[model samples]
Structures are given as structure tokens and as C-alpha cells.
Target: MNFSSKLLQNAVEEFGRLPGVGKKTALRLVLHLLKQQDAEVARFTSSLNLLKEKIQYCKECYNISDEEVCEICLSVKRDKSTICVVEDTRDVMAIENTNQYQGVYHVLGGLISPMDGIGPSDLKIEGLIQRLRQGAVKEVILALSATMEGDTTIFYLYRKLKEFDVQVSTIARGIAFGGELEYVDEITLGRSILTRVPYERNVG
Candidate 1:
């Protein structure tokens, strides 16, 4: 696309770099921003700048947070004995929307995708193990997506967590194969969580 202004072209290019944003969509976004008042544009950019500068990862669960620890991890009302393991903050948000789980969460940065070079070391597995070692947790639910990588991560985690006394379980297959938690509806996701099965049963 040709642009009369380099500033507009640059803005479009930058916006296009975002996932799922094509050049056309990026152009639309840039044009919309350009139409906004200067103060409104400043506020929008300021919020993004502040997010990049001040966002913190929770020390305990590695979820995105404004503080050193996420509110869920610090909540007294949460079930400290049950930890729901998810792929990222988005998955955490998806699960939270269900309002069916009182347990806290552990966010693995990503799943174990060998093709993408993501492995256990690339995730927050050790921190999760450490939490389990502290002995407060009684159950660890593997709430990863129903993809091959998700299954791989769950199997690896099950092996590692089996050494611990905690019960290792996985969300029910109410989710079809290859489904990501973020895209699943709240009711199905909530029911899957409610009817999780022991990880050992799926192994053989």
C-alpha cells in the first residue's frame, strides 16, 4: 500500500507486526488513531508504554500482574491446596471466567513444543515443582490445551510430579483434540475442570 505520509506508513507497519493483524487491518487501526484527538492518542500510547514499562510477572505463578505476586495467588479465599496449571495468562483468564474453580493457578510460559524449540526448561516447571515441594498443594491439575504439545507437557509434568505425594490430574476431554483453552466456551471449560481425571488413567 502507498502512503502520502511516512509517519502513517510507519504506524501501519508497526501495527501490522502484531499477531493476527494484516497490513489492511493495521492501516485501519492507524487511520482510526490518526482521527482521534491528540490527547486521546497520547493517553492510548501512554497506557501501552506504561504496560510495557511496569508490567510484572507474578513471582509465584508467573501470571501477568501489577505487583510482585498476582491477586489470585495472594487471595486467602483461594484453595491453596489445588493448583490449576495453564499455558499462559490468557488461559488463566479463560479459566477464571468460568467462576467454577476456587483454586489458584500456575502459568507455564508455554507448552513443550519440540518443533518450536520450547521445552520444559523454557517453561515455569521448576517453580511449580518448588511450590509442590513446599507441601501445601494436594492436587495439581494440568489444564493445558488438547494439542500434541499440550499432551507432551502434561506427560512430562506427570512424570515429574508423580514423585510428589500430590494427586496429578488433567482436565476432562470435554474439550476436543487440538482445542485451546482460550477459545473454549466458559461452560465447557468449567465442566472440564469440575470433572478432571487422574493423569495416570490416560497414560496407558
Candidate 2:
């Protein structure tokens, strides 16, 4: 796309770097921002800068937060004994929208995708194992997506946690194969969480 100004072209290029954003969409966004008041644009840029500088991953669960520990981990109302394991912060938000789980979470950061060069050692699996060893957790819910990578991660986690006294379970197959938690409807996701089965039964 041709631009009258280098500054506008630079902004569009930067916006295009975002996932799912094309050059046309990025140009549109840049134009929209150009129409906004100077103060409004400043606020928008300032918020993004602050987010980059201030965002912190929760030391306990690896979830994104503003402090050392996430608000969910610190909540007294959450079930400390049940840890719902998910892929990332987006999945955490998806499950929270269902209002079906009271348990705390353990964000795996990402799945074990060999094709993508991600492995158990690259994830936060060791932290999860350490939490299990602490003995406060009684159940570990594999709330990962129904993708192959998700299954691989769950299986790896099961093998690691088998010696721990904690019960390992997986969300019901209400979600179709290859389905991502973030894209599923709230009711179906909530039911899946409610109808989770033992890891042994799920695999058997």
C-alpha cells in the first residue's frame, strides 16, 4: 500500500506485526488513530507502553499479572486443592467466563509441540510438579485444548504426577477434537469442566 507520509507507513507496518492483522487492517487502524484527539492517542500509546513495562507473570501459576502472585492465586475463595491446568492466560480467561470452576489455575505457558520446538523443559511443568509436591493440591485438572499437542502435554503431565497423591482428571470430550478452549462457548466449556473424568478413564 502506498502512503503519503513515512510516519503513517511506519505505524501501519508496526500494527501489521500483530497476529491476525493484515496490511489493509493495519492501515485502517492507523487512519483511525490519526483521527483521534492528541490526548486520546497519547493515552492509547501510553497504555501499551505501561503494559509492556509493568506486566508480570505470576510466580506461582505463571499467569500474567501486575504483581508477583496473580489475583486468582491469592483469592481465599478459590479452591487451593484443585489446580486447573491450561495452556495460557487466554484459556484462563475463557474458563473464568464460565463461572464453573472455583479451583486455582496452573498456566503451562504453552503446549509441548515438537514441531514448534517446544518441550516439557521449555514449559512451566517443573513449577507445577513442585506445587503438587507441596501437598496442598489434591486434584490436577487437565483443562488443555483437544489438540494433539494438548494431549501430549497432558499425557506427559500425567506421567509426572502419577506418583503424587493428587487425582488427575481431564475435561469431558464435550469439546470436539482440535477444539481450542478460547473458541468454545461458555456453556459447553462449563459443562466439560463439571463433567471431567479421571485421566485413566479418559485415556482408557
Q: Against the true structure, whose lDDT is highest? A: 2
Model 2, residue pairs in steric clash: none
Write candidate 1's Cα lDDT for 9-75 as tens digits: 9999999999999999999999998999999999999999999999999999999999999999899
Give the C-alpha lDDT of model 2.
0.94
Off by over 4 Å in 1: 175-204
The Cα local distance difference test for each model comes to 0.93, 0.94
- For model 2, give the RMSD to the true fold: 6.6
Candidate 2 residue 170 Cα shift, in angstroms, is 0.5
**Deviation (Å) of 107 in candidate 2:** 0.7
Which candidate number has the best TM-score?
Answer: 1
**After superposition, candidate 2 runs with Cα above 4 Å error:** 175-204
